[model samples]
Target: MTEEKYAGKNKPALSQSGVRWLWLAALVFLADIGIKFLVLDRIGYGWGNRIEILPFFNLLHVHNYGAAFSFLGDQAGWQRWFFTGIAVAVSLMLVFWMSKLPAREKWNNSAYALIIGGAIGNLFDRLVHGFVVDYLDFFWGSYHWPAFNLADSAICIGAVMIILDGFRSKPE
Candidate 1:
């Protein structure tokens, strides 16, 4: 039994290629920051300063000082630093996890990369502007969804990928 345990101990892994995915994360970050900059340059900031795109869509500039859907946006102001610290910690953990992931697990790594990129993007906003820039808007009738940007979309997509990966991991 002891010999059996040691027999395969030195065997190498099937794949160790998560490092390549970091580029994907970087791309996400660049895209997010770039679009945000474009929005800032074009639309600037204000409520009545929006341009109508579709009947239900408008390119508006709104700053979110809190988490998703402006969770603590109305807080006394400590939430900004709190969310920034959380993002940093989460991003570091994701990078570490991505590094340790097997290269064969592309979906897993992609999810991690997207999440890391999104986290960094928002963290940058928190550090520089003290809030996140949201532009995209959707509405039906008088009801409206909270505005969001590319980073937020990427994060949501990545979360969906995580759920799909979980579904695919079950034994066949």
Candidate 2:
């Protein structure tokens, strides 16, 4: 028996969608950097003010030389190059992933953009100052969340969106 043959299946194109994804990524990166500049100029590094917006929320400025919560902070000099290398590698991988995504995969695309922006934001800091500038602080009593910046927030939000999208059916 002859094998069944199929032809003319319509594959979704991603050229346009990839461009949009890139544009959004660029915008987020710019915004993240712009805010950092403003904060650096107006507030200056290592300077922060606290406002009681709730029972357990405050904004503050803190520079971190290591990973989250200042882990490996005491390494003295190795972490700067280490984290910078990691960020650069991840950014490159994410860009390749973004290019491979189909047009209908909006959620994935957005997630990629966020991750890219965040990576670049931190990468810039590491390259320029050897550390990251974190300004958002949250705490309840003696417990305090690690200080973070807008780039971190974007990365978190994008990750959540991607996880949620996975549970949903794939777009046609």
- Candidate 1 Cα misplacement greater than 4 A, ranges: 1-15, 170-172
RMSD of each: 4.5, 5.2
Model 2 misses residue 22 by how many Å?
A: 1.7
lDDT for each candidate structure:
0.81, 0.74
lDDT of 2 at 54: 72
TM-score of each: 0.86, 0.80
lDDT of 2 by residue, 34-89 (tens): 87787677664453465446787765556788876788878978999998888889
Error of 1 at 160 (Å): 1.5
For candidate 2, the C-alpha RMSD (Å) to the true structure equals 5.2
List runs of model 2 lying over 4 Å from the truth.
1-14, 17-19, 44-55
Worst 10 residues of 2 by lDDT: 1-10
Candidate 1 total steric clashes: 0
